[model samples]
Target: MTIALRDAREQLRDRFLFWATLALVVASTASLVTGAIALHSDAATYAAARDQLLALGKDAAAIAAPEFYPLKLMRGMIEQVEIMGAVIALVAGYRAAAAERGRQTLALILTRPLPHWAYRLAKIIGGMGLAAVSLGIVIIATAILLPVVSGIGLGTDDALRLALTWAAGVFYLTVLFTLGFGLSLWARSPASGLIAAFALWILVVLVAPQIGDTMDPDNQVAGGVFAQLSVPKAEQDRIKAGFAGYETFRNGIEVASVTKHFERFTFAILGIKDTYTGAPVDKVLAEKRGDLLFLFLFSLGLGGLVLLRPINPDRLTKES
Candidate 1:
């Protein structure tokens, strides 16, 4: 417990970790601000268009009120985190193992009275604790900002959704952290560990998603690729249907990319997906059960692997 606490405090004081976390918060907050402005602008435009139409004796029934789902505004923040926040996890993970080796502290720490398994467990818990704290900041900021931005207080459902997203974000970041920690454990130096970690990050978060998007044109862009194509819905649907075995291919890609799984689950929970909007929260969750489950297993399995790996100071030092 002491080791865990000490390690967490050390991580908290790390300048790189602190600044990375701050950047994450700033990016997410910016997304919230931008989303708020966009929402207000949209509302204003709809009102103006409606007034003009009504004054011209157009049918009032034709105008629809844009349903302001406050939590949906967090879409940008979630994506930003998936992209930029992964780097934070990589840094934390790399530091967890690499810093100890670089400073030659691992040899002394290993010489302590503590059992090897216990020491390793403590470090893993400490790393996860730091990740939770960083994600907690995101959740708190989102909670505080949501009500102010949308002019609507969080309802029971909205609060639940936010909670779920927070949970997902924690799990997502922890997975990356564990991956980084594992890479550091295997590498000879901090630089090698960081490089390996970022390489994995690029492959998982960037390459996989881009390949998936390329394979399925409809999923290529934000707000659906068809939205920007000026294509009719029927034509889009027809084009989407024209592809053979695309659904299976797309699902396979999404399953491979942790980012996709996290994004899909969070988007469903927050009603960011068009099909999920106005749907019952329970139904959306039910639909996304596979994604949520896969993400949990993937994270926990990798974390467990890290926990089980032997932390030999001699091997780490020799490699360095």
Candidate 2:
């Protein structure tokens, strides 16, 4: 616990990490604010139209009031975290291993009361705590900003769903942190380890997400292809069934992307996906479980790799 606390505090005081967290908050806040403004405007327009219809003697009760989902407004928040959060994890991991490799500490800790497994676990615990608390600030900001931006407060269910999405973010961040931590420990130099982490981040967080999104047939057209063409659900399924092989290939690529899984799981909870919007919490969980599982597997795999290292003090030592 002490080590964990120390790890977190060091991160809090880190100049690079401070700026990264601030950037994440500012960027995501912008996204949430923009989405909220759009929603507020649309709702206002709908209300005005409804009022005009009623003034003309039309039944006002027949028209539906606009539903404002504060949680859905968090789509931008999710994106910011998806990109920046991974970078933060990598940096944190690089620092954690680097700290242990210091001249005064490496030999003593690796050879003393702290076994390599215990040392690795403590670092991970500390880093995980750091990731959680840092990323958690985004949620707090969302809660505080949502009402102010959208003129709507979060409902209990909305709050719960947002919490679930935030948890997914923490999990996603943790997996990346583990990756960075493990890779740095294996690399000959901390700088190389950090670079390697960023390379994978580019592949998974940046490139892979683009590949998956563009390959999505629905996304081929603005506002979704099927919706744009006014295709019925049954027919849409039929059309999709005809391209089973292509879809399988696309999904295969998406399945390989940690970013896509995080986005999928988060989007479903936030109701960003029209199909999942207004769907019961249980339904969202059941359907999105696969994506969450992939993230969990990443955490597991990276963690195991970290733990299984030979525990050599020489490896943790710096090049002389």
Candidate 3:
């Protein structure tokens, strides 16, 4: 255990690790500040819009509803936080193993009595530990700063939701780091490993979701389904015509109501809904955690295979 800790400490002491941690801290702080400001600005605009609607003879109940503007601000902040988390993870993962490979010290380090897997595991733990600390600090800072700037209180429920979101972010970062380490082992060169890892990250994190969305048939709907529902076409047309302008009014009402409802509920500290369209977010989080664990095992498995391969030091010296 001591040996492992020493190895991990040495890894973290490296210049690259120091710089990476610094970068994560700076970037996370900036992201939180920017997100808070933007959310506050949006909330102010929404309040003004709500007043205008009320002035136009909309009932106070309709204009002052909880779902009107607050939810939008919260949702936008969540998205920005996720993006910032991804950036921190990606940068940290690319540097984890690639830097050592670039220095050509990987082979020397592997030759030690300490197991190769131990070194890899220590790097993974240390890198992720650092990232986790940064994430926690950002969350804490955001919680305090947002209320001050936006006048939106952060309740226990908000903290819980943010915690779950951060957990997901950490899982994603761990997977990327392990995969990057594996690529480093394969390439035996830091630059090549970094490039390949980032390319994979982009494919998995960005492109895959888009492709998945496009491939989902549910995203597309045809007019034929409604037409074939056995209702009289004339009756359907009459209903549609009667409600021609209803969509706009209904949307406005929904927006106002939801906003107001959430605002009151936020004060009550009601937890966020953990499921989206029948899919439990907790289940998704578990799956992601499992995936990250598998990736770490795979990286270790490959690293062990690399270690088992016989290396002829004499042949290398002769060639040199």
Best by lDDT: 2
Per-residue accuracy of model 2 over 101-143 as CA lDDT, tens digit each: 7554766765677667777888888878877888888788877
lDDT of 3: 0.51
lDDT of 3 by residue, 1-320 (tens): 55346546665576765665455555545545655676677677778888887789775566444432222234433444345445555556556555555455655776788665566666666655655665566556555665776666765645665675455445445555556655655554545666886786566555544454444332445534345566687876786677657644543443232112222222222123323222333544454444334434543554455445443323221111
Q: 148 in model 2: Cα distance from truth in Å?
A: 0.8
User: What is the C-alpha lDDT profile of model 1 across 1-320, one tens digit per residue?
Assistant: 98789998899789988888888888888889877767767767887988998999998669876777777888888988898888888878887877777777777878888777677677778877887888889778877876676555678888788788888888888889888878887666667878988988899899987787777766658767778878898987788677757777876875799999999999989888878987887898889988888778898888778767777565676434
Cα TM-score of candidate 1: 0.84
Candidate ordering by lDDT (highest first) = 2, 1, 3
Point out where model 2 deviates above 4 Å.
Answer: 44-63, 230-232
Name the lDDT value of residue 301 in candidate 3: 58
TM-score of each: 0.84, 0.90, 0.55
Worst 10 residues of 1 by lDDT: 311-320
Clash pairs for candidate 2: none
The TM-score leader among the candidates is 2
Q: Is candidate 1 or candidate 2 better by TM-score?
A: 2
